[model samples]
Target chain A: MAVTAEEILATYEELSEIEAQFDDVETDIIRHQYNLSKDLYVKREKIVSKIEHFWPLVFEQAPMDIDEFIQPSDSQIILGALKSIDVKRFEIDTPVEGGDPRSVSIRFEFNENEYFENKVLEKKFWWRHGKDGFVGYVSEPVDIKWKAGKDLTNGLLSLAKAAWEEEQTASKKEGKEKKELTPKQKELKEKLDAEAATGAESFFCFFGFIGERVSAEENIEALKKEAEDRKKRQAGEKVEDDDEEMKEDEDDEDWEDEEDLDIFPQGDTIAMAIADDLWPNALKYFTQAQESDDLSDDEDDEDEEGDEEEEDGDKPSKKHKACAHGCKH
Target chain B: MAVTAEEILATYEELSEIEAQFDDVETDIIRHQYNLSKDLYVKREKIVSKIEHFWPLVFEQAPMDIDEFIQPSDSQIILGALKSIDVKRFEIDTPVEGGDPRSVSIRFEFNENEYFENKVLEKKFWWRHGKDGFVGYVSEPVDIKWKAGKDLTNGLLSLAKAAWEEEQTASKKEGKEKKELTPKQKELKEKLDAEAATGAESFFCFFGFIGERVSAEENIEALKKEAEDRKKRQAGEKVEDDDEEMKEDEDDEDWEDEEDLDIFPQGDTIAMAIADDLWPNALKYFTQAQESDDLSDDEDDEDEEGDEEEEDGDKPSKKHKACAHGCKH
Candidate 1:
């Protein structure tokens, strides 16, 4: 009963069909759940907003997926002046065809403090089906207007902002034009990179997150047509120029080089954690805040020096201390 | 903006209502997805069953959640005799009210083997909403009548099965009568406990999994009534016998001692990992078998001795080797 390569290939074909069906079922579930939970989430927002310091406390006790990214500086701003947070499936209610109901926008509201001047920051992620048959969130950079010398990312956000502007400009050009960094931009990027190598990033760097470094509209139609042709080929229909397709796949792999330059490489994961877990379960985290406070208090003596340890041991000691202080705000 | 204890309680009340709504939405989504995917899964099963050694390969490449539980001895039985595996939402289509749609029955079809007499071992887990507001799967033991000297559980399953039978008899008796273990049974339990303390238990013990050691019907009505009364109290309606309710809660903590005696303490988690992840994604795992085979080949030299290490290092080495040999079968 030795399975030949042909048999394995056939099995793969059958399984691919099943996988497609599973994907469709998942997509339907996401859309249906989005529509069903929309109003309830709206109501949830209204209720949670009534409680003071709710958003800050939720962030303080957020799961490691998000908590790992928040720097001590980020916590200072969050605990001090953070007002509220909201997450919305921005495309769910839209009538536009091809708009994904799973796409979300996370909005953070803050009070005036010794930080950025903006009262609101909203970051949107588009649920995308990639040409390579991979599906995930794709996002563009959302610029944060930082006050002079108040940049929490230590110039990384500013450098990334400049690069994003260049990308936007390049995207507007006739072809996929690559831009050369200005000398000043290069200097800033080098300094930021060196600094980033030594320390954890400020969570505010999430705003400057331009995931994948790929344009949303770039060759999308061509990619869709390619995918369609490949699906047809798999169904036993004769397809031409598979060698050319192979070459294109090789070209796609070159995107890895570009991805290496992303300032916040895990932006998509962090965003998902916030949108899916932190936001939806905010109330649970908010309630657990008191329990965590008590737990942290027990370790307070050890935690002061514990903050200087490696990332795994650096469990946001200062934030909890600041939170303990802010508990009386 | 200091949050008072009363304010925190108020916040908890508001959030609990939102959580209930979220739960309902989740239930609806689960039911809807189950119905939608039923036919597709049936079609998938037909296609997969036609392939030889599919189940064996899938078991070899399962996720760590499942792979960790499988002993080398268990793998021998699985890879040699396991023909197919099926998982169904058994109660999803039931017309009866209060039948949870999430309840699942996992069936493992086997060919004639030295391990047990049963041709098909099916374990059903009920989706239960506990009195403590925790929702999870609850299951009773499914007896596997093993041949003498061929038992992989090292006599643990036999002891547990006897205990389960006694408990079932006790459950049928009047006034929650407690069953006293026979002298032999007590001696066997102590031997098995000593053996388990020194080494990892076999995956075959899963068949003896009597999760939570509580009857499914026990106190369910009373618990529901208590929950309702608590809700009424939360909504500012006075409920009688508050002191009695507190005493009942205190008494419930006694169940922890009962839970400690479970032979397979992680049975619920293992069952969920299989049903939710391994079974649904069997084809993915089957395809991944060849890839893991290649990866494990690089480590095969060290893995021979690695098998004798602690549980973390004691991954199923012989299983993969057996799979590699069976690849040509």
Candidate 2:
């Protein structure tokens, strides 16, 4: 039998209610799992800290989702000065209302390196419900204090940061109005756009990630309004402004397209890969590195054991040894 | 500092213990989610049974993972007589020991159709821990009992079943010995192998899925013995028969390669897509179908509403209507 449009729409509304329940249960599961993993992660950190070259090796064997962003220069910096990495669901125990337990913070500690001044850099992602009826993690732009001529992002981060600041300033001055850029700003923006088109930014540019192009507070408010509107519609109330709603949807789609052209277009995906896959499976990655190294050693007929003592003595040799084995470093 | 091979090996052992703990937690989470979804799924089935063309429309919008296996002929059968589909975690509430809560059974109910004798065809997949240290679902070949000259699998299933029965008989008589096929059996086997090489089979061949070459009982016993051996090795006890173990590993690899050459090589993946993704997300797929249909109606400038009454009266027109919109049917 042919299904009427009305029946389809009604069924969709019913399904949406069921989906919402499923989503709630999923959130609860995540919150519980996050709490359970906390102590285990702490135990893991203690065991991993004493292991030499742990972080570098883990990064080297990271899955393609995360590895694709790491440039040779980025690998050099990582192999040379990257000390350790930590991931935590920072909001899991938060007592604050509206806090999402799934929001995570990824911390990278580095030794004295040529890249940046900061010894510890932490990037926090806030899991929020989007206005477009999707849930994802959003993050603010993190400023990395790069040393002179040591920016692995090739000045793209600085350019993006400036443009973001200008956008923020303009938004504050004139709500929801597009701001015209000055000549210098326009030139910098053009250069940034061109660099973004190439899509070969360093992994360090992950620090400059600003997902969603909107603040958390603004997103939460918009989602709340949308929810209220949905409830009103469900209660058999006619929602006016259909044309305005269509225009808003089109605008949102355009913004999403623009977001896709950013340097770190898949920032959320990368963040998820790091937080979910790379961090939890670090030990597996480390083991994989060891296994691959062993295979290559056998193939090359190299005395890697004899070189181990030299690697322990000189830090530079460790980098060289990794590079000799076809590592990006 | 350079990590020694001993240290890497020791770390891997420690990490494996941590991973096992994580797995336990994951299993518990899945059990809880499964129980919670049971009632919701029941409610969904009740609602869906009243909707016309529900199963066909949902299948039409299925993701590529599942859709890729479905042939045009399979689509015709589905759109013609498929009444409803149901997925259940059959082993979840089983009182038997070693019952896995994750094991699922997918049931497809059909109206009086030209394909098969049975009104309902159910395929069950058992979630098990493999001897190779990976956990996956395994299923036995399900008999479709197709009507004469109406077999969708083109006699492939029948040939496979006969070959499997012969293997079983041979194994019973001469434990682990290679089975020899009869001259007539060899011809059928050659035809089956050729069909498998083409990598084009009816979706009905999913009923003939036997995921792992080894029986579940054998796998479980092997895993238990391996675990015991690992414990002994960790305690500095030398286990002999290194060459035998290497040979067994090679044999297992060969078996895996042979399994990959089957008609439904990705049976586990397809089963997962059905149970986890397609079944749970049926409402989403149905909505997608309706939305896509609306878009096509607008593009074609056709009065789908005027034709709806005719579709309600005639079953074949529903298939024609779907085909008109570029569906495989």
Candidate 3:
């Protein structure tokens, strides 16, 4: 039996009502979450500003090289420090003026990964909208091969890298199942992929500005392109009617499935670093500074240790000496 | 120390970049999920349409009353069958010509529920968006007081009703936590809540149509109003700056959180009912129809029992007689 037009109309009306209900509720929930995250970001920013004030002074005075601080090596505890060398670009992708961009992001990746074995953090910056501005989220680390003959120094990184490399090779040998596409469609898809790959690479070339960061104008242009390219990709997904790009970004999708709207990016790395690795030393420094005001006691245990190590000769390297002296001036 | 304007801009830009990256990836994931859900909805709809073809015929001829089919009373197993009485109306909310409506919902609820204790199934049709139109979802029963002297038939309902009534009285006595709000805001909130409550109550007055269903125009207008009301409430939540509405529609939020873009509301009650309660009888009917072709055997023991009971001078009541006959057509 043929379905009546009336039945179709009735069904449509009901569906609209439901959609209205859900959209209204969801929008409110997301906005509320955003506001909460924003408030948190402000609190975090204050701590970060204080760290920024002191970090340069500490780096200048401490008997340790900049390379040691930035290297992706084990420090006897956590995996390693992940740093954002620079904000290569950013943009809000929304057509409506003043409408909050549902999609906001920043792009940055590890500038050096000499210690990493199995994977490299992708050069692409992952981001999410936060209350004050955009916040950075960690994208899944991309699998990679070591530059031939590069030595691995971190045990955990070596193990994970080897496993990932093995998986990659096996998968490559098995190959993707081929689907027949018209030459024109295949060419267009290849073009789009190549453009995206090229964009990702040139997005943060370090030598272009002769050791200085890219100018603000260049950064803004890059941000615009990133937004435009993403828009194009979305359009492509809808049009391709094919399945090539379907397999791309599966990890990112899985991550999204596991997370909720409340999972905003916490963009203050200085605050994160202070919490993660610097708190103990910072507390010790403050305690000593306060005690020294009342009386000069035997609070210079680290300095004494450094002096003893120095008497034992050049065997105690700068890093060891810095550690012994508590890297405090 | 003070934060420089440049430093703030740099931080904001970095944050924006990270957010952009995440938003792009998430949007792609959600769109993919939506496409998958749409496909599933289409497949489910085909199966439902086939079931719809035969159900009305069976219900017309079968020895069960419409009331028996729709009532919220337990028979042998399972919750009572809640169904769509009709797809009463539909309209696109968008003003743009031929633009699909953002809101469409079917109205339906359980016809009766004397068995529920703490809650009763309110006569409100909960709806979901369907691929081609609208689908009805089962709403939980509402709470009600029985007319002062109504007899309770179901033991479970009686127990629940008493407990719910007690809770209501206690809460009413306790009073709500006071919040400071402008008199105008307070009045507006009260107006909105009262409107929503009233809409919930009369949304499904079956007798108002005088045995016929409500007109499509009325349903369309009602849907428009519901959509408008929801939008206003969301605005209210933002303005009220209070937590009063924070607890509202938590279930809907949980449902949204649980479901992905691939989640579409399945709208066919005929399909739901057949799967739930009618399968055994339907199978038996098909099997008997096949057997009667080969031989005329008095295989229906229940039908024979029904004949005997009828001859015994009105001893078996209507319900018992129906049960004896297997309620078969």
Best lDDT among the predictions, by candidate number: 2
Evaluate model 3: give its lDDT.
Answer: 0.29
Better of 1 and 3 by TM-score: 1
lDDT (tens digit, per residue) of candidate 1 on A262-310? 6786787888888777876675566557545654676565554333322
Clash pairs (backbone) in predicted model 2: none
Task: Report the lDDT tens digits of candidate 3 across residue range A247-309.
Answer: 252222221212211111121232223322232133222223223322334445546654443
Query: Worst ten-residue run, lDDT, model 3 chain B?
Result: B315-324
Between candidates 1 and 2, the one scoring higher on TM-score is: 1
Clashes of each: 2, 0, 44
lDDT of 3 by residue, B69-168 (tens): 3322223111232322222112222223221221122333333545223222322232232211122232222333444443222122232234334433
lDDT of 2 by residue, A198-298 (tens): 87678888876776654667556755764675586578554342333544664633332345325565677778888877887676567557656765666
Error of 3 at B66 (Å): 30
- Candidate order by TM-score, decreasing, is 1, 2, 3
Candidate order (lDDT): 2, 1, 3
What is each candidate's fraction of native interface contacts (fnat)? Answer: 0.35, 0.13, 0.00
lDDT of 1 by residue, B1-329 (tens): 67787665555555555666776897799889889989998988887887878899988877776788888989999999999888888788664334567778899999999888989999887766444333556677777878988888777777777766765565455343334554444655676669867787888778767654334553365346646855874687644433345446645343223554567866877788888778876755664565455546665554543433222221211111112112311
Best candidate per DockQ, number? 1
lDDT of each: 0.66, 0.66, 0.29
How many Å off is the CA of B250 in candidate 3? 26
